[model samples]
Target: MNNARTSWLSRSPYWVLSMILHVAILGWLIWYGPVRNIMLERGKPKREALIRGKELEKVIEQMQRSVAEELEDRVTLLKNGQDRMATNFDTLNAHFQPFEENQKATALMRFEKYAAALKADQESLMQVLVQAKATKNFDIASKAGQEKVPVMISALDEVRRGVLLLSSDETIAQMHALAETALFKVEKPLRDIGSLLGRHRRLEREIQESKAQVKLLGSAMQASRDEHERVKKAYDELAAKRKAVLDQMQALRKVKPRNNDAINEANEVFKKLNEQYKTDRKPLSDANRKARDNKYQFDRVNKRLDECVKAFNGLNIQTKLPEYLQLAIDNLAEASALETQVIEQVLAATKDQADESASEVPAS
Candidate 1:
């Protein structure tokens, strides 16, 4: 019995060793594989996803900053432009006051007032833009379901309406005409003097010859001097008129255009005349010269007067006469352009910001 038990033990001994090895391996796996893996997972920071989220966060931050800076710059520009328009309105008002008192009031006076009001409105709109920027909540479309969206939309609508009201065609024409008339007034005297000088030369020459023939030389000499003095006086007066016109033109140029057509025309004319005046010739006719002087003076004055009449006749009623309707149109047009520019810029910046922000949002 002892020998049989020993034989069985010996045979089973290999199986026992194999079982022991298997158990040890299983224990090691539980300690260092499945259990260890669970521990590692619990301790891990989700580094890849966390890194991706952080990068997206930085991108969003950069987009916000870009939008903020752009809005700030736009607000600054609008404020400066509004201030300048306001100043121009004041200057225009002061300029028209004397005309009103003289009972020579043109539609221009009322137009200026309207223009001033329009500029004030623009300033107000700019203030709204500033407020919107400060809020950093310009997402009207996204916030449409919210109460704030309605308020924002309403504000924007009001601004649009105001702009439309200010930029009417009639108002634009009036402003253009006013500016052109002012410029024409400046050129009037110059034209008169030029013609007068030509006539004086002809008259003086004719008188000189007559004096030599009739022995009335002394009287002719005195008359020639008198004529010369008259011409000089007229020249001086015209020069003064030109200076006044130029001052007004400089002021007008600073004003915003209400209509492209009228403003552009006026600008072209103003520039042309201004250049012409710079090269204006002085009266060179000798008043003592015979026959030629008398004829020259007569012809020159007649030609100048004719030219003046023609120029005055050619003036556009819509632009030059200060008609109430025209002035109204111009004001409305200018306001519209200003508002449109502002709104477009604001929308574009906002859209760009939204796009960038969307791109930064992590994919689910």
Candidate 2:
């Protein structure tokens, strides 16, 4: 038994050494391999998460800057448009200055002023849009979603209200008036020219009749010759009168209404009519002596008729005509149509803005 015990003790030392080495290797592996690897793997995910979070913050900041820039650009465009509209109104108002008639001219002036007002309203709308953009930016920047949306919605609502005011019928009426003024101012001169033309035609007919009378009288006696001379003298006097009338008509054609392109065109028509009068008058004045003698009485009547025709020709009828008159009507119709279109656009935009604003507001 003693001998066996001694041999087992001797082998125990080797077993102990083997166990110790195994434990040391296992400890080293836990400290430097799996445990450390597990810790490193866990920390890697945390570090990656932090980097991704920073990247997301940068992306959000870039988006905010882009949105802000876009908002600023849009606001600037809107302001520029408003300013242009104001300039247009100023031009239109200056055009109204030429009107001698108080009633019509005053109406036109009022309309132009209203157009200016509409432009102001447009500016107001732009301001509202700016406010909305600011609020939207606030909401986006605020990571807390609940607080941001409502503020943005309120700003949008303000924009809607501004748009609604601009689209009303009252605003449209002003636009219509502006157009009517332009149309009326244009047509006034045309009507005067038409009247002058009518006068010229009458004078031409009388001159023709006098010439025919001279032809019927065919050289007969000394008395007839003397009568023919008298007729010629009378015809000369009439020709002078006709020439004066034509000169006056020509002068009138050159007269331009201030700021009205349509009136300018009507004035041009008058110029042509005056030219026709001069051409027709020259022929009658240059007729043969025999014809003049035969047509002496007729020539005098014709001369008076020519004078009347020239007077009528100088007067513009389009301006003189009623509102419903088709031939010489002005741009009022077009202006009214444009006004309606603007109103409709404003209304639609306003409604859309309102809806969007409503959508943004949180439910009570």
Candidate 3:
């Protein structure tokens, strides 16, 4: 027995050493394997990140440059319009010179003052617009300046009509009528665009509100469903317990006759539990009704949101607005050109009349 025990002890050390070596190898693999992979990954060159960052910066710069160029182009177009209007005023001023010979000077002087004021207002608006564009905050400044443009145009229309009244030439009257008609036609589409913009804003707000209502109603519905499930589970558990009690009472009554009081008490408890279960049905029903009602409201809000989105998309202004604006520009240019021609014609007629009068006068 001692020889057997000594042989077992002699093998145990080898077994322990083998186990220790295996555990040490496992620990080393577990700890150092991931560290080696991480070191390798860290050693790899990060050229992609540097390249991507440079590309992103270039894209940002390009976007900024494009925005600046677009703003500058719009400003230049506005500036050209202002210059054209100024030229029209200059034409009116020249034509007024001969008209003033007949004491029709007050109207011309009033027009000149208004033109100067319009020019000053336009310059200030342009400066505000330029600064706003630089900061990417042109909402108020842009609208203010834009609103002023139409007012100035209306004033110009009045001045043009006033000048036309001073001239009696049929050709001048015809040209003025044509220019005024074209301008009126242009104004119609602009007013339509403004109305469409207002409607779009209102529809956007309605959609946002409807979406919020849908979210809130959905949450309420979920809560109601959860409460309904809880009430149903609790009632079911109580009913199950009452069933078990009734089963035990039946067995007890069959086995013993002296325990009638206990049986009666169990029956009473079962009756009460059955009544409680019946009462619990009302809460489950209420929860279900609440959930259904909330779901219905959520559906309604979702429908409203969908309708608003459809209306917003139907505006299609992105596709049609530029065309309308171009047409307006073309009409305005034609009107301005026609007005200039009428002014020149009126000036020539006035000059010719003065020459005829001078020729008919006797020498003093």
Query: Which candidate should be chosen as best, given lDDT against the real structure?
Result: 3
lDDT per residue for candidate 1 within 194-232, as digits (tens), equals 344445455555545543534443445457667777765
How do all models score by TM-score? 0.18, 0.24, 0.57
Per-model C-alpha lDDT, please? Answer: 0.50, 0.51, 0.70
Clash count for candidate 2 is 35
Q: Rank order by TM-score, top first? A: 3, 2, 1
Clash totals, every prediction: 43, 35, 0
Local distance difference test, candidate 2: 0.51
Top TM-score hit: 3
Off by over 4 Å in 1: 1-289, 316-364
Report lDDT (Cα) of residue 157, candidate 2.
38
Give the range where candidate 3 is weakest over 10 consecutive residues by summed lDDT.
136-145
lDDT of 2 by residue, 34-151 (tens): 5334444454445544458889999999999999999999999999999999889877866874452354334334434554454443344334323423453221221222232233
- Local lDDT at 291 for model 3: 81
What tens-digit string does per-residue lDDT give for candidate 3 at 160-201? 655564566777777877866765555654455556667878
